[model samples]
Target: MAFADACNWINGNVNSNLTNRNSIQAICYSDVKSQFGLTANHVVRACARVAANRLTAKRKRRKVREFKPTSFDCDARTFRIIEEGYLVSLSTTEKRIKVPMRVSNYHIGKLQGRPSTSAQVCKHRDGNFYIHIQLKSDAPKLKKSKNVIGVDFGRRDIAVTSTGNSWSGKDISSIRDKYFRTRTSLQKKASQGTRSTRRRAREILKRLSGGEKRYQSWLNHNISSSIIREAIATDSIVAVEDLTGIRERTNQKPRNKTERRRSNSWAFYQLRAFLEYKGIKEGVKVIAIPPSYTSQTCQKCLHIGTRNNKSFKCENCGNNCDADYNGAKMIELWGCSVNQPRGSELLSCDINSRATESLHLPYRKCR
Candidate 1:
């Protein structure tokens, strides 16, 4: 109740111009304490959280919505790990309470000696509460290598590497289609069925929600782990396309209903995120290169080529190969260039030019 009140207070007071923590606390500290009866520590943390959220939304150019009380932030002063790491003491509006956490071997190992200064108390939809402890540690030095492995992402083949490794998206696509049909049927029944049938349908729909997303996440984790292991084995840098704004850019073009759904459902960003964090933990260098024309350029001759479906053929060099594999090779070359001192200058192509059918010149190294 106290957490919810504090969040609501912060949400009501926060705005575009007054998102600074110190400034907001200066203005609303007295009001928060008096109105919500939150402790000074809770008030401070709530104000800081709202400010942080606003800053993130601003960076992403997203709208600031009213904050929900699903979670609350805590600091060292408000929370502490106790009972030899099995219990956590949390400060609440009523009083300080010690809660015993369900411990796993993995959790014990991770929290054995780490200093956790902050945490967030979250309420899961499953009606259970969980605390996320933030542990800080020094990052390992990145592995340096001249060898580069590029990964190309697409709907047909989820990920293809320069080393000829590929994960086909056929199974995933079929599973998604099945889920889509099931959801459509359930939604119709939920709206039009008899009372008992509608109730059952709604319950099933609720249970089915997030099933596909969880599967996608699990698959991405496996794929990223494999790619990172490959990079570690060969001592190579991992290079992927900088797909920022890709969905928005592609959505502008006309497409059929199924195509649009598949395109929107692609979890390439999550895969990239997994690769990045896993790389950081494993000390691998994961970098992003220009994505424009990667699939249409020939790795053998560095010339713009004709791509048909899954095949790419370079007229200039007469090089023919799998389109995704060729793109991965070109990405590897681009990654090599990016690693060099004057690499950016060598990649002088107009990246903003979205002309796909036009005859654009290829990238060339400076003499």
Candidate 2:
């Protein structure tokens, strides 16, 4: 349609009383051009407008705020085939999107603004292109209703089994010490001047991301395997205390800038994320229970009271257990509550437990 006519129609019909895109699309292209003189260029821009408006409406429906128009950088970075037809700017890639195209070659997702990074594809009715990436490496399934486990993890250890076996922290302590040294050196260097400090900080951040990726990869792979193996061996649910709020409460101070940077490398979420997918893939149930009173309440008698930072004696059962163990025990209890049926039963099970479960996820806790 002519730009003027198109604009006039759009403005007048923008309301509920006006014709929708479907109605507009129903009109013959020839008639639209003849009546409105809309050029091919106008159609191209209109296509973009349609896509953008659809995305905006969808996001709003999903309660997503802060929507914005797609930027050139966003398009180039994510979409490999944006056929804006020969562009005049350095911003556009030389690659052309034309016919005989293998749909698999299109490697872009609708969301996240990142490449799909694969060569297989699924096309939706609305022309949403999905790349076929192997999102999961399947693990052997396990029988449900097997022996379950209760675990405790803390500053000194990562996992403690109900069988009294424990996996303590040679790795965690060593990493922390390494962080301390790096942090101290960075602090000493950064204290010199602003420009140098900024430069050093950037370099430190780079190193930290690399180190964190490595550390997380190792920890996630090893720990998830060990936990899953243990669960499989016993045919039991792996019960963990929900530590979701731990990050919000931590107030630890690093000795130096290097330590601070290294601390950032610690993918705290990786451990849980791995456990989640590992459980799903293995067909084992993993549960995270309420954290409160896990440490202070006695395991034997359900006692609740604060003691030393490391140890706590339950007031009810007089159970002498590590605070971390208490936390794990509480998690186990909460897990039990979750599996039960009925809203009343779920609530009746306990107030301290709030757990979220996932299905068939591959552990991506990058070491």
Point to the candidate with the largest lDDT: 1
List residue ranges in candidate 1 displaced over 4 A: 9-18, 34-37, 50-70, 83-85, 190-204, 248-254, 313-320, 341-367
Pick out the ten consecutive residues of candidate 1 with the lowest summed lDDT.
350-359
> TM-scores for all candidates?
0.79, 0.49
**What's model 1's overall lDDT?**
0.89
lDDT of 2 by residue, 31-139 (tens): 5445555454343333344445555656577421322222211122222433333111111122433322333233323322333332223454366544333322446
What Cα-based lDDT does every candidate model obtain? Answer: 0.89, 0.54
lDDT by residue for model 1 (1-367), tens: 6766776677676555777899888888888888877778989998888788888888899966677778888998999987475999998887999999998999998888788989999999888999999988877899878899999999999999999999999999999999999999999999999999999999999999999999999999999999999999999999999999989999999999999999999999999999999999989999998899999998875677669999998776678899999999989989989887777554455422333345457898999
